[model samples]
Target: MKTWLTRCLLGGLLVTSPALAQDDDAPYAYPEDEPARDEQQEAEEDAYERRRRQVDETDDFRRVSEEEGEEGDFKELAGVDDPNIGFAVELIGGALLLDSSEGNFAKTVAGLGLRATWEYGRTFNLEPLRENLWADLRWTYGSYSDGTDFIRGDTGVHYFTVAPAYELKLGKTSLGIFGQLGGGIGYQTTSITIDAAETKVNGIKPVFQYGVGLRGRPRLSNKLSLSFRVEAMGFRRGYLNDIFLGGSIGTAF
Candidate 1:
């Protein structure tokens, strides 16, 4: 009986020893906090996403503002509050068709003139004839050379006028067709060359002017413009009529 009990005890000891060795040789496992780490990483990603979205939104707003600015949503963007009030200088070169009543001296003459104008835009509505009513104060100087054989002569006229004008705008653009009527007083001087001798006539006269013109600002720039005009001018004491066809390149401010 003692020998059988010893063998049984030895077999039990051997089985338990193998199980203990297997447990000791197994790899060590630390407590996992993966859920906490995952929550922290997810929170950081959400914050970064929110910040990126805000930046994108700000950029979008800025882009929209710039677009509005370009479309002329702001009145002061170009420092022009009144589009109609401006100043211009014109160079006029053309032929002056003098009245035939003065005989051969009244023939078509080559002429040049300079004009400085201050324009007041849209003072009233003359809806019957035009869309808008405007006015201009203009100073003008002109010189004419007669080509007729009766006498080689030159004439100079200087004047100032207040012109009430009408403009018909083309759609919403900066182009318009305009007409003006003006009257003023001026001095006239004429020099006639005959037999190598020069004789001059000087006098003061009442002047009247009427014109039709096409005016435009290129690329919508209000500070500059070009104009083409045809004018019929008369002097009470000098000539019956002088017709002028010319164009002007000018700047406005």
Candidate 2:
């Protein structure tokens, strides 16, 4: 019995001893070493995440830069449109009426004139009242001659005016009618032979002007247009006033 007990105890001890030997043969790690290993793994993961974010940011920046570059290229390829501005030359024929304290000094004086204009294409569309508004700067020079029993005189007038103009369409066609009203200053010189004596008078005066006209482009071209205008102008100073009626032929550009 003693031998059998001893054999059983020895068999159990051998089995347990192999497990202890296996545990000893396996690698041993300290508590501090475990924390270091975990920290190294975490650091590697954080580095990988940072590199991934950097790559994503770089891709996004490249995409935005490419889009902006394409937009700039398109804008460069497309050109801006032209604004409306033009030049005009005109020839005018008119009648001048002069009045002084002596009633009507000259009943009618025939005149010829020339005009140069810079048409500015900006308008204040006072809607319902008017549209197709236009403005212009005009320089005009005119000469008149009168030969009557009462008065014999030659007069020259020069004016620089700012005209606010408006247009009304006659129809759907290219032909349109226009009107202009202007007020500014002018210079006038009169040489008269009264009682066979030559007298010269020269001065500056305030001028008011108005016009109604037809304007249209020719059938062959739109770059050029023909214009016909009937204009009336008046000058006033003290008790002296001069009135003129005129017609004009002009080219528009």
- Largest TM-score belongs to which candidate? 1
* Cα lDDT of model 2 by residue, 19-137, tens digit: 33445765778777675458888899999999999999999866754564444642221111222235667777777675544564655666566666554432222232222555656
The lDDT per prediction is: 0.63, 0.64
Q: Estimated TM-score per prediction?
A: 0.53, 0.50
Q: What's model 2's lDDT at 61? A: 64
Clashes of each: 0, 0
**Candidate 2 deviant stretches above 4 angstroms:** 1-85, 122-131, 139-154, 192-199, 219-222, 232-241
What would the per-residue lDDT of candidate 1 be over residues 107-148, giving only the tens digit for each residue?
Answer: 565656666665443232222333245565655566767656
Which candidate's lDDT is highest? Answer: 2
Candidate 2 C-alpha RMSD relative to the actual structure: 17.8
Shift in Å, residue 62, candidate 2: 31
